[model samples]
Target: MPGFTLHPFTLLTASTVFMILPVTVQPAITTPINAALHAVAGPSDATDRYRALVRRLADNDPRWEVQTAAWSALISDVPTAVTDFLSPGGGYEKARARASQNASRNALVISRTISTTTATTSPIVHLTAIRASYGTLAEKDRYVRTGLKEAQDLDAKHSPVEQARQQAQQDRDYVADIALHGSGAWVRAAAQRAIQKSTDNDIQEFFKYSWASAAGCDLQAFRMNLVEQDLAYRHRLAQLIVLAQQAQHAYEQASEAAKAKAAAEARLAWSTAADTAAATQASWLANQQLAAAQAQSWQQVHDFAVTASTQQDWPTIADNAAGTSGSWSDEVAWAQSQAAEWTAVYESAKASADALPGANPTVSPSPTA
Candidate 1:
């Protein structure tokens, strides 16, 4: 009968004790939170520590479980603090802003590095082009100078502009010609740089036109020298022509003068020779006449004297004839007297002829009748 009795008080007390023990006061979760904070250093360490804390908190609190989910999603691939996490319409708008700023900063740094590399390498390429262009220009300049000097040394004739312009043109053409011929990569690069660097339209246009003009690289230097040479040759030809004319004129004048002088000498010589021949003829004629007259006079005297000698008885006749005959001379003595008189007359005539006007011995005698 003692085993059959039921106790409601004992059953109520057992249920109450079970409920109270299950719902008792828990220790603070601050200890694990402190541990997680202390472990934070870098992103990797922070991520590990945060994950562990999330698991611990998930054991007790529903809010902790929710926070853990959010943190897990935030730091999964992106290592970050829970305080710096981002979500739409969340209370971490500032945290999101900070994270975006950090990303932008990193991007800017990478961009600067790339820009520096390009700037440095680009100049080197440009420099190489410039060096090539310089070599081409220098070679062209040297060739031009050689041609110019040769022309100068040889005294080649040319126009004034051609002579001076060749030198200036060589300098200008070297750059321009190289650009036109595309002789060097540097030339194109330099031109581009100049255009890019300069803001002025004048400078840009100048380079463009200059380069275009130099493209041909012809033999302008030789042509210029040739022009000068042509001018000099013309001058020399003119001088020769003038000298020939002068010589011809002088020869003509001299020939005329010589002819006149010869004519005058002939005239004088003919007149002198004729006068001498006439004087000689006149003297010989006079001597013959005088001798004949003297012979006649002597014959008359001799005949009369002979007649008186035969008639001696007539003394008066004999005396008269003798006196007349005594005055007469011999033929030889009379001829001598006539010759002396003619000689004096001929000498006077020769002196008078010599003093006559227009009597030049150097000229020849003129025509006579």
Candidate 2:
């Protein structure tokens, strides 16, 4: 645990899981959808095809409310029900839509169930819940019917203590990644200490409470780095101003033959600096606007999550909302800092260019992003 290091992208995977959940496509009972679609092609063949479709619908293993409706059609007058089931906007399509609605509601319940402390503590259930939360409606339907039992069976293979031991190894891999790539020295140290403790309780502590402390430490480090960068930018500008003054003086004192060339070179140097600085300034301004928009987008997500908690009672939305808020908030801070820094650089460069000899100070770089 002392020197554990993982690839940097390992943390990217660790942090963003819902974006990349594994999809296991289970084989369905054959001909279900095809049987429905082709059931009423013509009156001659409709009888056989309708029976085939009914059998297929009946055979859905983890079928939702749709199967019950299919049974209703099966028990009624066969010829009339068959046509009704097969025609456009008919019994089969309505059943499926109802099933989809049921699946959606089940997905919400499953999300809240797995986010419960008892369930979240189990790694297998946690994994299953993530798949259900981000998965499609069909996937959620299958998960609601079968995935919970599968997760429970997997969890039963080991004692709770053993499961926790296995989970600690996974957490160690994540903490090791943080130790290497986390923003501040303090955060890295905090990650390292969690890895060294090598206990399930300690790792849980790190995830639950210590992560906020580490983030606070990184905030201080970020501010310090911003100051360092701003000071370096100003010092570079000071150097450029001094060079421009020295070149102007040199051009004035140059002999007749060299004065023209000297003046030309000084003007070119200051003009190029102004051009480069202005380009950087515009780039940062655009980046600032983009960052602000991203922050606003995350705020919308947070608002939706709040609404979901009340309307749908989905508590799990809060975790994703909080993570996106923190990440986008960083973007907002960086954009603001860089935009201000580059504006200063551009102003200094422009002033130096204007004071240089033999340059048309009125000529400015185009202000375009």
Stretches > 4 Å off in candidate 2: 1-198, 249-256, 268-334, 337-369
lDDT of each candidate versus the true structure: 0.31, 0.51
List runs of model 1 lying over 4 Å from the truth: 1-256, 310-369
lDDT per residue for candidate 2 within 156-267, as digits (tens), equals: 7743432333443545665677677643345466677778877775566455445445544333333323323333333343344445555666887999989888888777
Highest TM-score among the candidates is held by which one? 2
Per residue, candidate 1 scores C-alpha lDDT tens digits across 36-152 of 222211123433433443333233111222344555654556434442232222223332344345434444433443354332344332222232222222232332335324433
Best by lDDT: 2
Whole-model lDDT, model 1:
0.31
